[model samples]
Target: MIDFITGRGLLLLSLRRMYELWVNHSSQIIKQFSILIGLPLEMSNNSDSSLEVFSPAKFPKAMNELSALLEAIAATSIYFKAEIVVSYIKSHSLRIEWIEANPALAKIVTSGLLKTFSLETLFEANRNNKNFLRDVENHISKQLLAG
Candidate 1:
């Protein structure tokens, strides 16, 4: 029985190490790709893991790519059991501040954007959720254009 318990503990340790390695490898890949594509990606390992993708142009295609990358990360998080919060920062810092100041608008926009991903669905990342991207793009366009 003691030997069995020791073997089980070792197995668990190995699995955890593998998960950590995969997470690190995946993050590096994402960072490299973001740099190659000229997108500024910042990942933070605070209490709540968060990824911030800075879009200098706020282009639709760029947003789409960001959404795809986010979905991929979300899919991977299932096995690793991590919750990742994603944020998009536009080029205009003032605009982001304005959005944050307006709690109602912030909630609406955030909810609309997150609606694209069924995060409750474990192990499946909806990388092809273009509708969510469209919704987010439309909302941002309207806000920026109106201003």
Candidate 2:
């Protein structure tokens, strides 16, 4: 259908239609993601500023914090993501701070993850390798710590 329309010299029309579809779809997607990530979203009719896509502009801090937490789970996960990131920061005496976090780190992360991802989604992502999330955590700890 796209080729059919574009070949007939309705290229601008087709592009406009695709953009419309994208705007409609992305708003819905953003809303769902906001709920999952436990973030507030306010969409106003007068602004195109809210249409931005996800980027590392604000995620690196979150990633580093998450990496710090996952360090307790399995040492390799964070190292593999950024080689020597943890050790190098420590050696240089660089401090990475979290933005207003709870005292209970594990519970905080688990609650956020539970909100962000459903069991069905997790199972699908892991190809149904383990049925229980606790088992998954234990398995990683055992495997990484043993080796």
After best superposition, candidate 2 residue 104: deviation in angstroms? Answer: 23
TM-score of 1: 0.25
lDDT of 2 by residue, 62-138 (tens): 33443444554442332222212222222212223321222233333334332223222332333333333334344
Clashes of each: 0, 0
- Model 1: per-residue Cα lDDT over 50-95, one tens digit each: 2322232533444454454455333222211111122323211224
Q: How accurate is candidate 2 locally (lDDT)?
A: 0.39
TM-scores of all predicted structures:
0.25, 0.29
Query: Each model's C-alpha lDDT?
Result: 0.40, 0.39
lDDT of 1 at 107: 44
Predicted candidate 1: what Cα RMSD to the true structure?
15.1
